[model samples]
Target: MLEKLRKLANILYWAATAVLIALPIAALGYLLAETPNPNRASALFPHIDIIASPTGLAFWSAFSAGALSFLLFIGFLWSLRGLFDFYRKGQILTLHAAGAILRLGKWLIALALVRFMTLPTQTLLLTSNNPDGHRQLAISISDHEVGFLLAAGLLTLIGWAMNEAVRISDENKAFV
Candidate 1:
């Protein structure tokens, strides 16, 4: 039963990752193919312009950033797989496993934080104009993105903590 559950989790994680990766790639491809309007905001803010020429530098930068983000996302998914495996095997109830899980959790949290931090700068660069009323709106939208990211991060952290508690409880039971 546990093995089945682990496999399900892994599949779900990969599916989510693939969808997330596809979104950016599709947008990037569209930007490369179409000349964006320099005076207008892109549908995907901070990543591609709807009317601006896709410069070599911008293309490479976006590619690299996307690659890095994909790698990080993979790492998180793998860690999650491991954590799920441990839980399924009842190892999560042990102290040793708990410590390892906490470490992995911390890394995941850090990744989320890094992602959240970059979003604002990315948004500002993508949407801000040197002189316009749109700057404030851009900032506002950025703030909303940041808020959503933080909320998601917090939820993830809470789940990790709950797992930690379960591990600790299991360890205590074994000791007793």
Candidate 2:
């Protein structure tokens, strides 16, 4: 069972590494293919003459939000690699594993926070160009964010327990 899990961890580690390599390339592709429309309505302004301009505030806002999200996802994958490495070594009860879990949880929390912030930001950026003044300031908690937070909490607790178990096991070893 441990060997199987170790194999799985190894597979996941390589998969994440591959994604880390691919993510930037994909984002660059999206940016290059992005076409800005100038005639779009604007709530922030009567008319945004720079819609056709890639350097415009509207363009940058969308681009920046997207890049921020992509970077956060990359952070998650990077953090996960640390945790998975231990699983691959069958050292799940080690301090390193616990630390990796903590790091991974932090990234999960950060990702959720980014998701929370991005919604309103994207709404404002996209609708700032709306001339109808009907721009939405949308904000809501989605199931995905909730799930991420829950997973983070569970992993943290598991890591803590693993650490305790390892400490007890080490004490037993010393007694022998």
Candidate 3:
């Protein structure tokens, strides 16, 4: 069982690492090719693709914000990689795993903030490009984002408890 877990972790670690590398390349591709205007962005994210409009003061702001958010997203994946690395070595309850999990919580919170900023902007962007129809402005948070935040909080609590347990075990072993 332990061996199987280790193997699975190893495979997951590699898979995540590949994604960490590939995602940016793909994002860059989107920026260079499929990206819409930068004035405002409508993401409906978590559920749909982003809609970017090039016709507002929000363009550069939205673009820059998206870039920063992407960085945070990458950081989240990197932290996951750390967790997987520890698990692959059968060190799931170690300090490294705890730290990685804590980092995941931070990233999740940051991601939620990014979503808040971009979601409203996306509504405008989605309608801005329509040649005849009046541009529409809309914004709403998705259930998915809320769920992600909740999961993040749970992971943080679990990791903190795991770290404390490991510390107690180490102290007990010291007396033995």
Candidate 4:
């Protein structure tokens, strides 16, 4: 079981590393493309109708929002990578590993919050190119965000439990 866990951790560490490298490049490519992919645009601004192609101020505003989201994801991945590294090193029960898990949970919450807050701004920006009457500012909180928050909360609780476990183990060792 220990060996299998270590092997899985090594795989996760590399997967996280690969994503850390690929995410930015993919975002860059998406942003620099001559025409935004329709599906991606829809996914980005689900509540708004992008009647006209984003350009100038609208483009930059949407770009900034996307970049911020990408950065948050990168932070989350970095924390995950750190946790995986600790597991790979057979240090899963250490305070440092628990801290890394806490950090990952925190990062997830931050990401969810930012995404929640930015949805309206991103929609407004993406639709700013539409005719005056067609432009929109839409606010939405989807199940995805709610589920993300729940997961983050659960992970944070687990981290706290792990910390307590470590403390108890140390106390027991001292007593012995």
Candidate 5:
């Protein structure tokens, strides 16, 4: 069972590493593409009825938001990769693994926060080209943000428990 887990962890570690490399490339392609992706625009500016085509400041605003969010997600993946590395080495219960998990949770919360702030800003920027009356200030809080917060809280608790377990295990070894 232990060997199986180690092999699985090894596979996952490589998978995460691959994604960690691919994500930035994908984001760069998306940003540099001559034509805006309509589906992507719709997803990003869900509340806006009119999405001004990507041009000038509007394009920069969207680009910055997308890049920043992708960076945060990459950080999250790095943390996850750390945990997988630990598991691959049969160090799942170590402090390092717990710290990695805690960091993962923090990254998730950070990504969520960035997303919250960017949504309104992106909406304003994307629609800035519109006539004065047509401009919008949209605020959206989808289920995704709520879920991220909830998952962060859960991971935090688990990290705390892992710390306690490590401490207790150490004490047991000392007592023996």
Candidate 6:
């Protein structure tokens, strides 16, 4: 039963990771496909304008968000690999592996906090009417995107933690 539970957790974790990676890519692709114009809505955050030309900062920001998300997906894969090793080798209780999983959880939490902090700034930047307002709004929007990415990361981390705890608890029971 413990083995079956672990397998289920692994499946869920991988599936969630795939969805996380795919979402940003899809959003970015859609953004790129849209003809750039000052009046155009943002691909990811619908309220923001596309502006006449994409700034290096905007491009880099998007790239970074996508890249970070991709990296998290890779981390998820690593966690899955560890889980598989535990399942096959009955090594679930290993402290080293559990610690690695916890580290991943911490990363996710950090990502989420980053996102939460910037969301308000992004909202202000995206909605401002004047030139100064627009600039400020742009900054705010970028912050908001970061915040969203972080939130997603946090969710992923939470999921990983839950799985790890479950596995650890089950392993402990076997000893008792």
In candidate 1, the residue pairs with backbone N, CA or C atoms under 3 Å apart (3 or more residues apart, or in different chains) clash, namely 36-50, 36-51, 36-52, 37-50, 37-51
On residues 8-84, what C-alpha lDDT tens digit does candidate 1 reach at each position?
65576566567657766886798788645433345434443324433444434434444565567666656655665
Residue range 1-176, candidate 3, lDDT tens digits? 88898999999999999999899999888777755544324431323243434455545554565677789889989988888899999987677788778888878888877877775665465455555555556677689878987887888787788778888888988999
- After superposing all C-alphas onto the true structure, candidate 1 shows an RMSD in angstroms of 6.2
- Each prediction's whole-model lDDT (CA): 0.55, 0.71, 0.73, 0.83, 0.80, 0.56
Give residue 83's error in model 2 in angstroms.
Answer: 1.9
Clashing pairs in 3: 38-59, 39-59, 41-121, 41-122, 42-122
Clashes of each: 5, 6, 5, 0, 0, 10
Error of 4 at 41 (Å): 8.6
Order of candidates by lDDT, top first? 4, 5, 3, 2, 6, 1
The reply for model 4, stretches above 4 Å from the true place, is 35-47, 51-58, 128-132
Instruction: In model 6, state the lDDT of residue 56.
Output: 44
TM-scores, one per candidate: 0.47, 0.76, 0.77, 0.82, 0.82, 0.48
- Candidate 2 lDDT tens digits, 90-152: 987787887778777777777778878876776667666555656556787879889988897
Q: What is the TM-score of candidate 3? A: 0.77
Model 2 residue 27 distance off true place after TM-score fit, in angstroms: 1.7
Total clashes, candidate 3?
5
Model 4 clash pairs are: none
Model 2 stretches with alpha carbons more than 4 Å out: 35-55, 167-176
After superposition on all CA atoms, what RMSD does each candidate show versus the true structure? 6.2, 4.9, 4.5, 3.4, 3.4, 7.2
| Root-mean-square deviation of Cα positions for candidate 3 versus the true structure, in angstroms | 4.5
Expressed as tens digits, the lDDT of each residue in 93-140 for candidate 6 is 565556556665665565555444444444443444335435433334
The C-alpha stretches of model 5 lying farther than 4 A from their native spots are 35-59
Question: What does the lDDT read for residue 60 in candidate 5?
Answer: 71
Better of 3 and 4 by TM-score: 4
Q: Which candidate is the best by lDDT?
A: 4
